[model samples]
Target: MQSIRDRLEIILSRLANRADEKVYTKLYSEAARAAADAADARQKAGVGLGLLDGAIVSIKDLFDVAGEPTAAGSLMLASAAPASRDAAVVRRLRQAGAVILGKTNMTEFAFTAIGDNLHYGTPGNAVDASLIPGGSSSGAAVAVAEGSSAISIGSDTGGSVRIPASLNGVVGFKPTARRVPLAGAFPLSMTLDSIGPLARSVTECALADAVMAGEDSAFLQPIALAGLRVGIPRGVLFDETQAEVASAFEGSIRKLEQSGARVADLAVDDLIAEMRAATKRGTIASMEGAEVHEDWLAAGASVPVDPHVSGPLSRALAIPASVYIRTIRRRTELAASMDERLASVDVLALPTTPMVAPSIAAMTGDEALRDKTEGLLLRNTQAANQFDLCAISLPMPGMILPAGLMLVARRGHDRHLLGIAAAVETLLGR
Candidate 1:
């Protein structure tokens, strides 16, 4: 096998233009080389070889890696004390024999779907430099797309992983909330936060997720497409979808149908409207997020929250306790309702995002436009989070610019979802 150290060197060399301080805020060169050396030594001794042995993996900045401050893509936490030990998942990754590349950048506190960060630079989309990479897992997705890592770990709350993966044309998996430990990562929404992997393929994500969960590699069984039922909601998710994105999504539906899968367009507006109402009622992330940052902000650990993030947090801080509690209850009710609605389908299908990646210029020039675009991007993927569903984003076919076809399954069915995704991926080709 190729030496792990050599692979790290090769990966780093490709990152020469990965958008400075954005995709990767830190590079654990010496530490990674040391780990790589150990892996190679173990190989020679015929021991210490695990599933991810010698693989290079990049971590989202939110993950706590011992001895490094988890800045979470903000300068506010830059001076925070180093972590005492690796986050549970990071420890698991190491145990799986992977080389920890470094911490990747993200939206400040992972508060936004858009990747822009005032403190740390934004990682430009690899598919289109002018575009804003989908985030708060922006750097994690870009790192994989840029070939800087074989796989990257990221946190998903409200479509963070799926949005970025869709925009970057890579596979993004958001397992059930409790599928992986959340002990070490900085919190965005305690209720919705999930840890998952973004990689070139579904099998890779499944393998990484298994290791992170401290479980044996899942046996991926492919479900035949002939009898598979893919549900495409007729409204809400498709509302305001750009022409190009809609075309790509429709094309994928056609392909699946031709491949023998039965595509059903269901009247899902009620379920979707309920999700939107939940957001309007109150955001769980913003509510819990305010609590999480209250101390730090009061002490001035984070002096000035980014405008985009501050708007929501400030409102959340003022949210009456009753409102927050009500919203939580409403969210649970909505999740149950949505899951129940999926009884007739094998999986839910929709565009991963409402549009192709928009130029960062368009977003930067008009504040209102930026807000609007970001909201649209989150429109589709956030449903899965709201419904507490396990979801994956796969690239759609014949796209000059990348678009994604998302597949969502009921929560707690992550492994089975991955298997279904793998079957779809195969139908679409690698």
Candidate 2:
């Protein structure tokens, strides 16, 4: 392999001629060059950091990088006070000797799953520029998919990271919410926010996730596929799933079965319905997000912000405090129930997004269509956040348009889930 510095130069050259501002909020070219040079020097001296040393990485815009305001894909906070220090994850990434490429674009306040940023402009899907790149980790996935970065760190609050990764045809992992510290990250929903990684392979995601979670950066060993129980939650989540995505997901399951994995239908539709009922007032994420952005919402019309973000937040704010409290309490009970229900299976498999990437022009042109599309996109993946589970989206092979086969495991089983994903990735010949 070429030296880290040389590889970085090639990536920079490729990006130099592209209009990538929509994909990257800010590029750390000077900082990246310095870090790459250091990594190269360390290599020459026969000294180096672990797995992440000399690796190029991109961060979602919500993370604070000392001396810069975390705009988080919004113009409203473009002039916000600069951060006094790097975010916890950012500091950790540096300590691991990872080269910081840039801050990738995201939905304003990480609110929407559609991935279009009116302020920073939207980043087109990595496979097809005209399609919506699934968000709020839009640029993070695009950066990795476009090979501008070796890996990308992104926040997953209600499917942001996995959705984009699925649409972009890459690996995206959402660890259990508390696995990684959230300090210095712009909050969307404190309750649901999780930091994770996107990369070309499951191993890269695992390594980056371990570093961010403050765990040992050791290579992951694939768990045996034989006799591992894989559950298929076959209900509302599968509703309206596009034909191509459905076919691809089914094909993936067949491949796993052929590899000696045990596959069965785990009936969780009732539990899903109950969970939905518990949050009828609003989801835990939207309710908590409203609280985080109270001042912004209070500023109302004076603050120019995306209506898609503000509208849902405004509605969530109107929900009675008592209702929000009841929902939170009920959610805890539901999450526990989900954990118990999942004990029979090693993991649950589903389509990451019910549909493939849709044209950005179509989404932007029709308001009703946009809302409907966003709901469909978030349906399957949001369950992991709602129930507090570790989930990963692996690109399904042989699809005309990219889609993800999501595998969800119980909370705090991030490492186990990554191992399973690695084994499955190999089975898929990815």
Candidate 3:
């Protein structure tokens, strides 16, 4: 209780005094302080709520906070009326006694992983102010990286959480699509959207995920590194991957091997190619995302959605409904093939992002360059959502550009995945 109160005070001070415009879109100052005080009282009365009691956390703007408009980093919804109820995740977190500091800024409509929202202003990477912070969960990751919160709850549709965490050198976990409730989170791709956490370590993520899932926060049990089977699936995921990310990932693998883990160079290229082909050159998020926003975009709301964002959503309108259905059916059939391919391996390991953070200046205002860069950033992490797998990105040491080594497991293996990640975090720190 005391430790939590101390951290809350520091975070409050930082949020209050910091001059960074992009760090947060809103801060629940009075509510957060009151929550902290109540938690302290519970501790004094010997009636704690749960493990996260008094823990300071941040929510993405897209999550419903009763009576507050879910701007979702968009100008379109900026003046919309407040929500009638709290998002399910928000309620669960509150039940577990979390102190939500405020809603952080994000990519408008959670559209791009590039993290630029000309309307709300994207967060600058904590590692490098000039570079772009990975998004649509940009500010959520930044809050933790910049010391405004201990944990952040964000939605991952196409590497939103992990991409930002990777670029900012923090741990981001995307649980299986079904693990966390998404009832009140604004949808990007309802089928692919999953809620998760970004924090300094896997242990913290494990605890936060549990709370989000309505479970008691428990300490993560570290798995044995020796004899752990790790697979690296071959595909377009590696094409154009930066040497910096490649070197760091490869080096991390060697360390794991030395610690007795079995690293397999798997031949899953055909599986990956078939899956990508099934989607017919466009992403699932693009198709589903268009349906969610087309009505509003057509109504002339004066939204600040960038060309990069509007282009894809507009293009998705042309996709035949049959195309989406056929693609989904094909992907569903291919899930068995993916399952068979991974049956032998305990987990898959890869770079969280194909490249390090690119300067905002380089991609900003250049539509072609932004499109190319966005694809590169989302290339690796997007696979997790498509394949319905639980994934996590752990910060890899020894790099000028921030790098993250991502670990993936079969869907519904979230707990096991976190345990493995905790073990890897320990080994990497060694």
Candidate 4:
């Protein structure tokens, strides 16, 4: 088999001019070549390597790579000082022998769930060219979906990682927030931010998560659906799912049941209520993002901001400080609720995105459509962040367009979540 780096070069050459906007920035060919050479050399040395050794991984532009300026999909940072060191997670990946392919585009400052970035350009949806490839980890998913890399690294403050992974038909994992370090990565919400992997398979995501968390990948047991308890929350998460998405999610559940997993309906009324109330008040993402970017905005750096990206982010900043404070308190309360409520179940399953991928035309420029799309995109996945739970978005089988069946676990139960996800993946045969 060709090394991941060799495959990436072929994919890059094939896609170089096919779509003008799918990828906004790319590393110099020489840099990629050198990484590829080093990977091959290390393999030939007969040294046991890390999980990602020789794997080509694409990163969202928000991560700081030494000598390269962190753009976060905003042109405003084009002239900012180049980073002198890699983000902690990036350093870890490099130490594990993963090749840094290039930085992928994202929603400006990782603010919006919609992947449309006007400055760096939106990554075209691989399954359907006209549809939106959910953001802000847009290009990260695109890189994997289009086979440009074996996996992509993206941050999920509130479903940024999972939304795109769902829409693009890949696996996305968001470990419990505190389990993965966030140092050196650009912040969206310091409290909610998590670095996770987007890969072709759930097992691959598990491997990546192990590397990020500095855990032993060998200890992650394969999932066995037999006798496992799966919960279906009986509220808002199911309220607005599109027919296709609903059917796919339901079908996946039925398959799991048939494969010996015991599925039950559970009420998370209070959690849903808190999430609704929190949305009205603005989320941790919006509040913390405003705090982090305050200085940049004060310096009149808005001109280079992508209208599609900043338009939504600017609205987030409009939220009152009082509301933000209350929301943070509520987030803690909800986290406590999740710990108690999910104590009995192995995993809570839901549709990763409430709706399927929307048309790119529908997501761009129109404020109402943008808001609607953003809300729908992050609806199911955001609860994981709100409650400080670990979650994974696994691609459901038989969907023409990518849709994820999300599995969420209780706080600090990262390993258990991976086990459940692995079992679910086995049951689903994907």
Among the numbered candidates, top TM-score falls to 2
Candidate order by decreasing lDDT: 2, 3, 1, 4
TM-score of each: 0.96, 0.98, 0.96, 0.94
Regions of model 3 farther than 4 Å from truth: 1-3, 217-219
Q: Best candidate per lDDT, number?
A: 2
Q: Please list the residue runs of candidate 2 whose C-alpha ends up more than 4 Å from where it truly belongs after superposition.
A: none
lDDT of each: 0.86, 0.92, 0.87, 0.82
What would the per-residue lDDT of candidate 1 be over residues 127-236, giving only the tens digit for each residue? 98778898999999998998888899999989999999999999999998988999999998889999999999999998899998878766787888897988888776
Model 2 clash pairs are none
Per-residue alpha-carbon lDDT of candidate 2 for residues 98-147, written as tens digits (9 for 90 to 100): 99999999999998899999888999998999999999899999999999
Candidate 3, residues 1-430, lDDT tens digits: the string is 2556666887777666767678789888888988988988888898988868888899999999999788888877878899999999999889889999999889888988888788877688998889899898999888888888889999999899999999999999999897899988999898899999999989889989998887764767778999999998756677888888888988999999999999988776787778879987567898999889878656644745676778888888778888999888887877777777788998999999988899999887687888898888888888888888899999998889797999999888889899999999998998
Q: How close is candidate 3 to the true structure, as a TM-score?
A: 0.96
Sort the predicted structures by TM-score, highest score first: 2, 3, 1, 4
- Residues 167-251 of candidate 4 have per-residue lDDT tens digits of 9998999988868788779888889899999998777787778888887653677677888889999687788788888899999
Task: Decide which is better by lDDT, 1 or 2.
Answer: 2
Q: Once superposed on the true structure, which residue ranges of model 1 sit more than 4 Å away at CA?
A: 16-21, 44-48, 296-302
**Residue 278 in model 1: lDDT:** 66
Q: What is the lDDT of residue 133 in candidate 4?
A: 85
